[model samples]
Target: MNFAKPLPNYLVKRYHGWKATTYSENQVWYRRLATEGQRPRAMVISCCDSRVHVTSIFGADQGEFFIHRNIANLVPPYAPDGDHHGTSAAIEYAVTALKVAHLIVLGHSQCGGVQGCIDMCKGQAPQLEAKESFVGRWMDILKPKFDLVADVEDSTDQARQLERQAVVASLENLMTFPFVSSAVEAGSLSLHGLWTDIGEGGLQCYDPKEGKFSEV
Candidate 1:
């Protein structure tokens, strides 16, 4: 309970710098945003990786996108068993409340979470398979897709395939929500699956008809 601490000096300095420049230059816009609230056109569900800068990658300014970051960017099937569902909560808010038109699940290359899932599935990380591990439990959402890439012998290729599959899995899970499915059926909301290569800065989009991802 007493673990809270003041901001670090480096972060405080950076905050002051941004406040003096970006905030000062856009003071009116910032005030308007505070008064009017966010009205983003899209909802982005992405991995909680520091390198995955959703806003920066899309050249989005503040309040342009509703972004939710979770480990592996996995969305579980609609489970309304009264247990807390952070990703589902965000999806509900974005779909029903914000009425975002596009729901994007952004997966990326060299994801640590994906690697963890691979290791756990391969029996290389028994710690992650422990019942008490939060990550292990959360990663169970993607375990079903692991078998699709299990036959691939190349480590790099297998990882890449699974990474894209994560996005596909999340997109599939998104439709399980009644609100999302209804919105999609009504032509109000659309779902997209995207994968990015971190080192190469390349992007790919999933084509449901082709059942594959192609470069964007």
Candidate 2:
């Protein structure tokens, strides 16, 4: 098949840089990782947004985290209807196959997906309201959160609240999976919710008892 386009020149340069610096420095380690399968201790579910750097935030090595990124970092409620559910499939693989100890839903400030949810719910984004829009349907998981922060007057504040709410919502949805629930109940797995302030470079962790996000 004929290719549509060549790899971007900037990305090609970046790959060459990786091959020179990090790859050269960690040749043996990289080879070992290639030979031996990855056994990540935690799975990080984050947004597809380029700004949210999961690896950079944790200063993680290549195999340290099994990362899954999707628009808005949302995990919809488990339906088990035999449809294509990428997030759910990843979660199942992580919990059952990887046996990761922690499943972290990492949300961030100024998520376009969350904003889209806000707009679509408020009749601002008609395109998102359409049934055929993947982003719109994906954002439906977070749409229910707008009501949680309905009283917040400021738009940014509302988006922030919804972002945190998205983390909490994904946590709840993860528990809906039988494997996740059983593993959690049997003490094999733990769930955590995290929200990051992209501009301020601050991290806030969810406290279920306080029902708020506090800076970490």
Local distance difference test values of all predictions, in order: 0.96, 0.94
Which candidate has the top score in lDDT?
1
Candidate 2 positional error at 38, Å: 0.2
Look at candidate 2 and give me any clashing residue pairs: none
Best by TM-score: 1
lDDT for model 2: 0.94
Q: What stretches of model 2 exceed 4 Å from their correct place? A: none
lDDT of 2 by residue, 63-132 (tens): 9999999999899898989999999999999999999999999999989999999999889999988899
Off by over 4 Å in 1: none
Quality of model 1 by C-alpha lDDT: 0.96
Q: Which pairs of residues collide in candidate 1? A: none
TM-scores of the models, in the order given: 0.99, 0.97
Question: Candidate 1 — worst ten consecutive residues by lDDT sum?
Answer: 135-144
